[model samples]
Target: MGTFASHRLKNIRTLSNQVSLNGYKEPSQSHPCEKDRISELPDDLIHHILTFLSTREAARTSAQSHWSVNKWTFLECIKLDIDWFHLDREKFCNFVDKLLLSRDNVNSPIDTFQLSSHAIDRASTWLDLAIKLNVKVLKFSEDRRWEPFYLDPNLVVFSSQYLKTLDLSNAVLDAIIFDQLNNACPALENLMLSDCLMEVQQISSSSMKNLNLIGCSFIKDLSICSPNLVSLRIKDQRMGNSSSKNSYLVFGTITLIDASNVEIMELSAIDSMFTFVEQDGSSPMFRNLRSFRLGPWCIDDNFLPLRRFLQHSPMLEMLFLKLSVTTSEPPSTDGETRQERSSTAIGWLRSEASRPLITLWPREKPLPPPPSEATIAAATA
Candidate 1:
């Protein structure tokens, strides 16, 4: 592997030299000092060149000759693509375990490591290695469904101290994952969790500035205390079987307490949760929120809270409601009260229909000219 990496690096250098020769605008003359100058470059400069290639490629270069051998060990970024090596699960696991144990003994500080694997055990080991290396950015993913029980969320937390960005998909996380994470990764700034099982619990953080939750199912109780969150996105898992409403289940209320500094919020669910309406005297959850998107088909009487919540966003610049409205089992209140409430809502929308729509184009664009008086009279005639 080391020899191959060295050869590839030398090839790259040759190609670069050829390009430089072709592109140089000045007349060149060979000087005896030129070779000495090239050889005088610090070892750090050669190691930087090796770091640009894959770990395998870099190692291959090390074996090209003695000069390249020690240079590969100074790599700042160790990126490994196991697929290119044609190794099975057992071989891959052993390879990573050896590399990590050997590298840690030398106290190597790996800035970045990307491992794509089908073996969960290998991934777990790599995670441990990353934590030991004090990796700055770690990306982990699997193409095969490895047993989930063998994976530990603690390892992820361990990586969080030095980790700045994390992208995890199609994995199972123990419920206590958040507890470990909150304690370990106080510096995490960007987070993406898609199709992962998270143990439902309180998720309080001031460090996360951007969050995306996509295609996740088991959200029992989600609470956010991050006041500095700038972008927030939550999307429901798509259903493919039936078009009917029988599959829908209204779960639990999702509360947001301290996320008032959000600027962009996109929320969509297959079921309705009482969306808190920010009122005149009420405390707003998202005070700086400018864009709000809600799945239209998910709204029902349960969504009245959300409508009421809208009044709180005085600075709201955009409102998108994709309603597939359905009727829910009404409360025990008399029909008269329900009718009155419905009427009031209709009247409010009617009155505000002519006003500048936050969801529409320009805030100053006049609403579609109200039905022409002549057209109304003609319909009556």
Candidate 2:
């Protein structure tokens, strides 16, 4: 086992050497002083290269190689990708236990700790150690080939006040995660969730500055309430059975309350959350939104929801529309042909682009007083 672990670590120096090649210089007659590019790398990169090594291998390398003495002992990032080395669960667990114990002896604060593995059912102690170490950025992802890791909300309260970034992928999130978010990582500014399973209907955060959601859905119940968020990106793609299209109708509302300071936003494939108008036709506002991106349904009435978004964002300067030429949903253009309706919408968009005023475009189709759900859904569909 130790021999195989050492073999796994043999390539760390090679990888680091590759990264350092840009700085490497062949011995030249003009430049007398030979540059040791590998030694010039920042400690963070060096530590990352060393992450694959077990403690024993790291000690041997430090003793016999050109590495700095005891530098691995002070690594700020603890990234364990057990699957990458073909390490078994028991051996991986034992290695981590010893490594963390040795790290506890050093009592150094961790800047980042990422774990990618399938043996995380007993990962609480590892996470707790990260919190104790005051890790600032933590990324934990489970192997998709195994059972999903259920993230316990109770264990999330990262006692570390310095924790600023948290990324969780391929896990099952509890609804209570939102309830304990503020307390879990009070100073958290960036939160990224990708390919997770959850029924979290609403995600509310006041301190978070950037929030990214990528393909995170099980029942499509998702909303957001973040007043201090500066940048937001959501790429919603259903990750379940392809035969079930009903599960794909998981667009939730964006509780755009107290969100007058958002500067950048991207809503791909799920723009309905932000542009959705209730039966009464009331919609929220984005007073300070400066840049916006949207993914259009590309079917009939798609421009209707877009109209609402432009109307709400008074400060929008850069508008990016990802025009999809194809969509599975049928057109709902009433009697007007797709070409005619598309021409009208495109012309209106052109006219609006030329105008500086944030006013409504000219009424085309006898505009209803309050567009009903059927109407909004048709447009947003």
Candidate 3:
């Protein structure tokens, strides 16, 4: 009788504690942190949250719970990073095909679609979808190992009239491909191409306002005839050079015509020769250029080209130069320092500053300005 009573008492105490703990609510679990998490969010709120994540991560969220599982397919802006070429190609192709077909009922067009290509066949398929969806921003980054290869012709011809920004980096392309792209993309405004190889015979475009070509090689001559090119950046180690000695001897020229609206131009090239000559007998001018950055290899003698460019740019204001004393051609004296090279560059700028509407820096250091005077007056005089 005593043993039976002891067992009953222990069982009742255990049951009472289990009931009390289940009834009690923790402060954190009920409030904002866990409360605002995916399950608790409304459909619209969840859609906004998922937009920031890549398509892969957004798809994985479906495993979290029932609510998340049903909604992952509704993502509008999908960014597919197809870097793993080791995977079965057929599997990847089928997966992409299904994902695109699944979104046929979407209410809004895709805003951004970024892809990294290891397989051209897969990339072309994705690009076809972007055209169908009217994707606004399309970016393609090719794998580094695959080089001196051809691009899919469909990609060059595909047009997304609403495309506002285009970035093609680390790809081996040709001028013919670019010609097709420029013709297709009429509304494109911003373009960036870095570490790209193109035997670019000509660059023809319009409606492009900002252009950045970093670490890109040009073959014989580079021409920029776009009237709307407002800002241009050309920088990276040794741009537009061919390895062949005979090829190197052939002088390559860069032509900028009717670039009057450009406000900023940044250029950096090393172990390469360049000259910016305004087109002969042309009324074209740079009316709005305010800042200029030259290559580190630029010498005092290099300023000859800018004399005409400065005459056209009446509102020029700031200058940044990368000048070095050491060159393939040695300095006249051992005492020549980097500081002296900078001084030489500044002197050339000072000569250009004499223009009625431009400012130039003569000294090596930044100077304190009068507090009451306008910066334009200080910059000009």
TM-score for all models, in order of appearance: 0.67, 0.67, 0.68
RMSD of 2: 11.5
List, residue by residue over 172-268, the lDDT tens digit for candidate 1.
6655666655567777777777555555655666688888775554547666667678887775555443222212132455666666778667666
lDDT of each: 0.56, 0.61, 0.59
lDDT of 2 at 217: 60
Model 2 CA deviation exceeding 4 Å by range: 1-71, 154-156, 218-220, 237-251, 270-272, 275-284, 297-302, 327-329, 333-343, 353-381
For candidate 1, the TM-score is 0.67
Q: Which residue runs does candidate 1 get wrong by more than 4 Å?
A: 1-42, 59-70, 144-150, 153-160, 237-253, 271-282, 302-305, 322-381
Pick the TM-score winner.
3
RMSD of 3: 12.6
For model 1, the local distance difference test gives 0.56
Where in model 3 is the C-alpha error above 4 Å?
1-49, 63-70, 83-94, 104-108, 237-251, 271-284, 296-302, 327-342, 351-381
- For candidate 3, report its TM-score: 0.68
Candidate 3 local lDDT, 60-121, one digit each (tens): 45433345333655666776655432444664566566667666556446777787666455
